[model samples]
Target: MSRLDITHERASYQAVFALDVITAAGALIFLGLASKPTFQRIKQRRFTAPNSKNNSARDGPLKTTLGTYLFLWPALLCLFIAYVCRLVSDLLKTAGTINYDDDLGWNGRRAYSTADSGYASNISALTFTTALATIFFTVLLNGGVWIHSSHVQENGTGISTPRTKSRIWNSAIMLAMLGTGLAAWGLGIHARDVSTGSSGPHALLSWSTVLQHHRATRIMYIVHEAIVVAASLSVSIEVLREYATTNRNARDSPERKDLLRFAFAVVPLIWLRDIFILYDVVLLYVDTAGWSATAVDATTLLLVVCRQLANLAILGMVLWGAWRMSRSVALFGRSYYA
Candidate 1:
């Protein structure tokens, strides 16, 4: 069969394309709104004296600033690019010109795969970079949440504690950096393999199959998710602490409320995505004993749609929280809220 003699699930791709449009639009709007505050924070940091009291890092603690927490700008931008790429890739797939794999493609579609198709290799490269972008976004945001909570706790207390550095927190950050690097390395290997036609029988969109077959990528994915879950859990604890300490009637209550929203609403969704990932792995690789073929297909479709929807929801919540925090900064110039 010719490479172009491929069939695709038109309705499935159409649904995904629609989702991509909505997510891309939301990400664009977020970027536009975030640019001002993000830049203003940068400008403020440049002009302000390093020794100034406003410099939270001057004494001993990590510097907490709007820029530090507003990683949502780049995060959203990454997702936007990823979504747009997906849209384009879907279009290509519909035209039966992009590479596909019989073993990995949806519904056993026969087509050229990553091992043969240039377009497929390039798409794999894009997927690697975008996945790294997402990992960075989550890790950075989680760290920011923790550090911001620490700042809140320190400043909220009128008493001056010792100016000693937090060796423990510093060590944790370093370890997380190490893990992120390892994850990147693993993902890079996977991408390189795909591009060089070494990753056998891989399809452009066969993420679950890739994980199941590629040991390095699979291990690193688990590591990456573990790091995310750990960081998110820390943030959850810190947010709870903020809620316990913060006075509802206080001036900085809005900041507390925003954190609450992040913890209660956004964090849970992140956990949910991770759960879906774990379940996807289980259904795809682990628990396939007596499942009917129809049941397996249904589960696959359900996981694909639900996982993407979960991701979209997480992106929306994080963007909304960041926007709320940015607005708080606009109203009260570099206060703890920002």
Candidate 2:
């Protein structure tokens, strides 16, 4: 809105991507080690149970770990969203049908979205894909993790009934996700019609409806993040329960040491990532600051900085997870812990 030196934005993106490459490469190597025949044999032999004292027989062989599947689905979904976003921007640029100052008006409020500019089709498609991907990703990824981790905790600690029913929590999660997706698509349709200079039944969503969409999306994201944190806490409690009961003095065991490391390391990092991301999302909408250029610039700068910091923290978390996996491979060639 304040017409920032686009160069700064470009530089930040480049720097974050460079760090991501390193993180991705490190992760690939860690995953590669996991794929070795020797390690696979060892991993299958190790980590074959519910790590509880009461249920020694609950342990059995799993051909593959849950984390592997959980990570892959979300990654693919995010990649799809990013590709759609890029495609929308590239199509807009290539068509050269609208400039920021004219067609978009001041601060990117599209005063005129012409069909000739590809606003209706391309942007609508991108927005719909983004809505779908984010909704499905959050529901499947976090929901799945919470479910599996809860199962582990329940079986290990023998805590069958938590304070709340899983069904209620799951229903709330789905509702939040659905509301987010619907709001996004609704906002997108509103924008598309606005650009084409038509006031359909959808035009009931005035430009301010966009702000409402932003607010709804933000609130839903916070709720989802909190839900994930609660689920993660459940996992930690399960681990601690084991330590208190069976593995009270088994810190010498690599497996026991690994579990403790995970409770402290990965969980806190996950907490940090979620908090920073939530704050960044809030800062992003601060562009709606309206007339004050200084406020707009300040908010934008903070948003960018916070996002990069969050990205850095995410990479660090993944790198740490990879290192932990490597440690498991070294200590027990067939073990999979990450």
Candidate 3:
């Protein structure tokens, strides 16, 4: 390739690496959650639920609205379908066909070549669009949950106001997640594009569009990071504040303790994910020659693996919850409580 002719492989966030594996696993977990009747069955299984007293999960009536289900499941399905296309596109490509093969920055480490990489590029605009769609659906799914997370207390029980303070903030975290998703999508798209002159002078892509994508990625990166840090602090404070009351009578409840352990462990992983991602983002800006670029790649690989592990733990709980929840659904998908 010419000196100025730069080509890219798959985008980091959407690539079927350690991170997307984690995300794909979570898709089924989310699909189950979107099924209101099934989810309610899981969370409301008081018959077997231990020490129902003072449990935040046990208080509120289940959210079984059809509108919520509609918003969630379709978006979730889109996410899975998007990943499938991405993975298939990856599968079709040769291992490492970098446009700048001589450069150490993208030499042996990259996945596949861009559509503009050569005459036989594996990834097309279709894969690019699907990559974008996956993030969009992810944000949609989270937003649906954000709106509903506020129902911590039953309306008429009158013990305390719904933990609206924390719930609202949790929703805000979901909003941050949306921002991060969009940012990643933008970067991935721009990175996948064929260089302006590499394909043809006109080259289906415009400089302005690419620049816009880069700009969005930059702006959203900051927003996503800032909001994630804020949410972590907010969530930590909320959990600690309520720890005394939330777990006051919980010594007898092994189930509650297990759930808490899982949650506490997952928090650090989430932070780790953000840290590695921030490192990658920095590389995007000031990343330089030689071992530094390789180090950025290495650290990023570590980050994706760590994040996926966290997701596996968390989504395992969701799937487990779904399995348990399914038990509460009687014959014909009806709630056992009904």
Query: Which candidate should be chosen as best, given TM-score against the real structure?
Result: 1
- List where candidate 1 sits over 4 angstroms from the true fold: 1-8, 46-65, 68-70, 97-118, 147-209, 247-252, 287-338
Superposed model 2: Cα runs more than 4 Å off: 1-71, 87-116, 144-192, 195-253, 280-338
Question: What is the Å distance of residue 271 in model 3 from its true position?
Answer: 2.4
Candidate 2 lDDT tens digits, 1-338: 12212233344334433443443454344334334433454556543333433222224332223343344334434534543453344344334232222211111232222223324355445544644555554445444334433433333334442237565766575566556555655545545443234223332222322333444443554455555445545544544554454245433344344445545664565555456555544543544535465444444444434433333343334334333423344534355442
Task: Report the poorest 10 consecutive residues by lDDT, candidate 3.
Answer: 149-158
TM-score of each: 0.67, 0.52, 0.59
Ten-residue region with minimum lDDT total, candidate 1: 102-111
lDDT per prediction? 0.51, 0.41, 0.44
* lDDT (Cα, tens digit) per residue for candidate 3, span 260-286: 543465445545655654554454444
Query: Which portions of model 3 show Cα errors greater than 4 Å?
Result: 1-79, 100-127, 130-134, 137-162, 176-198, 201-213, 236-244, 249-255, 292-297, 322-338
Cα lDDT of candidate 3 equals: 0.44
lDDT of 1 by residue, 115-162 (tens): 334355455555455555556655555544554444444433322211
Screening candidate 2 with a backbone cut-off below 3 angstroms (N, C-alpha, C), the clashing residue pairs are: 42-334, 43-334, 43-335, 49-59, 113-195
Sort all candidates by TM-score, best to worst: 1, 3, 2
Residue 23, model 3: Cα distance from true site in angstroms:
5.7
Candidates 2 and 3, the one with greater lDDT: 3
**lDDT score at residue 303, model 1, on the 0-100 scale:** 62
